[model samples]
Target: MDSDRESNSSSSSTSSSSSTSSSSSSLSSSSSSYKMIKAKVFIWVDSELKDIYKIDEKLTWVEQKENIVTKLLPPLYKIVNKKYSITNRKLLKMLYGRWRSRHRTSNIKNQGDERVKQNKRRSSKNSRMQEKKKRRAHATNYLIENKNKYILRYPEEDLVKILKDSGYHSEEWEETDPEEEWPITQSAVVEDDEIIEEAIKQKSSSIYIHNKWWRSPALLRLLHDRIDPTVELLKKKPLTLKRKRAQSSQSRYNTSNVPPIGVPSWCLNQDALEQFNYSNVNIPVYDYNTDDQDNSDNDIEDENNNEEEIQNRTNSS
Candidate 1:
């Protein structure tokens, strides 16, 4: 009976020890799982936090990133996994640098394109301005060259059209007047005279003498005589009609009677005066000629004096 009791006690002790050990092992495993669930692991992709994973403390930063990338963009994950053979820190830095470089390149390209467009616009504007200047110069030269052929009053557009219609190209002909289809009439001459007179009245220096009118000496003489005297009078005495009218009206108001409208005493003629005969007139002539010998002697003396002075200066030098 004693042996039996001893053996039973030994067996019970072994069973209790085994149970305690099993319970302790279960508690340790449960604690490790709880710690892993509680611990936080942050994962980033392209500088942005993608996900927070509850992972074991044993996981490295590289593993975490790889997991994140795998979950987000699979293709990028492959590229990162294949390219990144260095440490996690170096890999992050390289990725950031690459992104920055790509963005910078794109920005530079965009700026360059914009600059090119601006340059093109500036060049086009300059070309257009140059073309306008050339056209203006050509038109001015054309007007100057054909000044004597056409009246100044003639429209530039009309002149161009007329020249084109006459089969005369502006580039082909130079400093020459084209022949006209019709002859100039007396009426046209009168019109030109009227235009010239009006231009003179307006204090204009330029005259529009048509090709046909240019041939008439009588008309030119008449215009010269009229224009010269009128211009001189205008310069010497500028008449203010308004002021004169005012003064005249005041004087008339001051007087008792109105002024007569008849001709003045200086202009009144009774037709009884004898007219002078310029055809058969005899006039006394006087001869007071200059001495050529004296003038020649004086010129010779001046020349000699100039030569002597020049010689003296040369000798001194």
Candidate 2:
């Protein structure tokens, strides 16, 4: 009974140890799985957290230097699914700080531009477009400059137009002479060139009596500056009115009496040039000019023929 009891106890001990080892092994595996679940990082395009972001472990130096991604959101998920710490400064600089500094430098230049714009705005109140708004608000059709009193009460526009057209040159029909009218001379055509030169001066002074002056007469100067250079290039031109001059008939007579220029002495008549045959005539060819003593080979050597040439020539033994 003692030996059988001893064997029974040994087998019971072995079974208990086996059971404990199995329990420990299971607990170790569970703990490891729990740590894995805690350490896992998820990055995706949506907030539902169902998907895992595609992480590129084999990123090249060029791609890391380029730093194409610059966000920290979930929906966009501009970064990869790898976990980062602030301690990894080199990695952060390589991925983002490289390209971001370039944009920061460009923003610095824009800051300078913004400062210049502010200075200009402060210097001139009109630069902020305040005058433009006032001009727009007080705009009018300028029918005789705010007339308060008129003698006629009711004159039909058609009848007034007819009366004005008939008596355009007569000053008695209107209260003021027509300032817009000008004779069609060359000076009159270019009269709008300097129309608003003294407007700034007149604005400060009280006495500004220019009846022909209207709003924005600088536009007339601008039109003249742009039109004068390219007036000849106009494709559709009006009928040219030629003025009859006093000496025009005399000029015509003088031009008719004058001979046509650039006519050669030998080619005076076209019929003679066509009829004459050079083959039957002995035309002597002069190799040198007889008038030019220097070029003539007529018994003159070393340019010693003329007295002037003899005096100008260098002395030789």
**All candidates: TM-score:** 0.14, 0.14
* Local accuracy of candidate 1 as per-residue lDDT tens digits, 30-88: 86754442221112343343343232223444555565344544433444556333344
lDDT of 2: 0.30
- Cα displacement (angstroms), candidate 1, residue 32, comes to 95
**Over 4 Å off, model 1:** 1-111, 148-317
Q: Clash totals for all models, in order? A: 0, 0
For 80-109, candidate 2 gives per-residue lDDT tens digits of 334433223333443243335444444555
Instruction: Provide the clash count, candidate 2.
Output: 0
lDDT of 1 at 176: 16
Residue 270 lDDT in candidate 1: 23
User: For model 2, where is the 10-residue window of minimal lDDT?
Assistant: 166-175
